[model samples]
Target: MSTSRLFSVLDKALPDEKIIQDFSDRIWNDKELNGTYVELNNEWKFIPDNAPLDIVTKALFKEYFEIPFGTYKVMVAIGGNYKSGTWIFDSKILFCNALS
Candidate 1:
């Protein structure tokens, strides 16, 4: 799916902050998975195997709301082998600015 379409689906699937938070928290707290996430240049990126993409994608989607403006990158992999190149969230995608 396209990035915007993927995000739209995620928005529909997680319609509220509470649900997003709960789901993201689970991924953030996962012992094995949590270590896979990192922040670089204000962007949050995670490399996960294909099996966990759904959960990880949701977690990154939640990050879009919680963090200051930045990109979210996902790099899919398996058994320490990368399956694809990075998918960077569009910089043009705007979110509500708390300071505004």
Candidate 2:
């Protein structure tokens, strides 16, 4: 078969808490008829900063946050819907954070 690619950009508002994140994953999937599926691969790199702290505690669940005044680079690979091994993927994204 053949392959296709797609790309998009999104703006997400953070909770105001000191935190940053790299996100990825499938946007939609139709499993019953095996019709459609999307995949996202995300990566993040942060500049050295003292604002961010890594805290580890004894708990079943943990929360993560980014430092208030830090900058970050987020990269993502989006896979578009397709059938079989041929992949129809999106262009990709390199997002830079502008500290608010």
Candidate 3:
């Protein structure tokens, strides 16, 4: 299945896409995040819905309230709480922010 939904959330949440990434960061649009990201790739199995994304991500790091998959200039997935805001933004946020 396409991970488009997951990517959408990440892109919307962050203020600066290049400066940061969020939870759900490890997962890519086309493939699973790499082994370097063991917590995401090795530990948690992906749940299909974004609703549960925050709860699951919280277990990893609460301070973030999200996940940043790769480091700067990287491929990442951002974690988001569906209750907090819209699932997708028309043009405000960029995919790079989600990948932060």
Candidate 4:
């Protein structure tokens, strides 16, 4: 009687290939914040794409947005608003007078 596991046999038959891991910082267009907004992990279930690969790819990169410094009531998630993450770049406005 043969008792070899199917996954084990598949692993042996498949060749390892280099996978390009390019992740964007912007959230994917889903109801849930699917980008850097959530804590990243390798344990994926009920999510699209391969769990391990998807987590690794998304977690590897980040995007920085240059937001003007001001109190902004920004919407984080759907109907979810927050004020803490707003950043103000006041230095640019302050230094512009010197250049003139």
| Cα-based TM-score, every candidate | 0.21, 0.16, 0.19, 0.15
Off by over 4 Å in 3: 15-100
- Which parts of model 1 are misplaced by more than 4 Å? 20-57, 60-100
Residues 1-100, model 3: lDDT tens digits? 4578645655454324323324344433333333122244356443332312221111111244345553323322333332335664321211222222
Per-residue lDDT tens digits for candidate 4, residues 15-89, read: 122111221212233535332233325533232222232111111112266445321211112221234446522
Weakest lDDT window of 10 consecutive positions for candidate 3? 52-61
Global lDDT of each candidate: 0.39, 0.27, 0.33, 0.25
Clashes of each: 0, 6, 11, 2
Backbone clashes in model 4, listed as residue pairs: 69-88, 69-89
Ranking by lDDT: 1, 3, 2, 4
| Cα error of candidate 3 at position 82, Å | 36
Off by over 4 Å in 2: 1-21, 25-71, 80-100
**lDDT against true structure, model 1:** 0.39
Compose the digit string of candidate 2's lDDT tens values, residues 14-80: 2222233322112123334333322225634322222222211111112276555434333222221
Worst 10 residues of 2 by lDDT: 53-62
TM-score, predicted candidate 1 vs. hidden true structure: 0.21
Q: Arrange candidates by TM-score, highest first: which order?
A: 1, 3, 2, 4
**Weakest 10 consecutive residues of candidate 4 by summed lDDT:** 91-100
Best by lDDT: 1
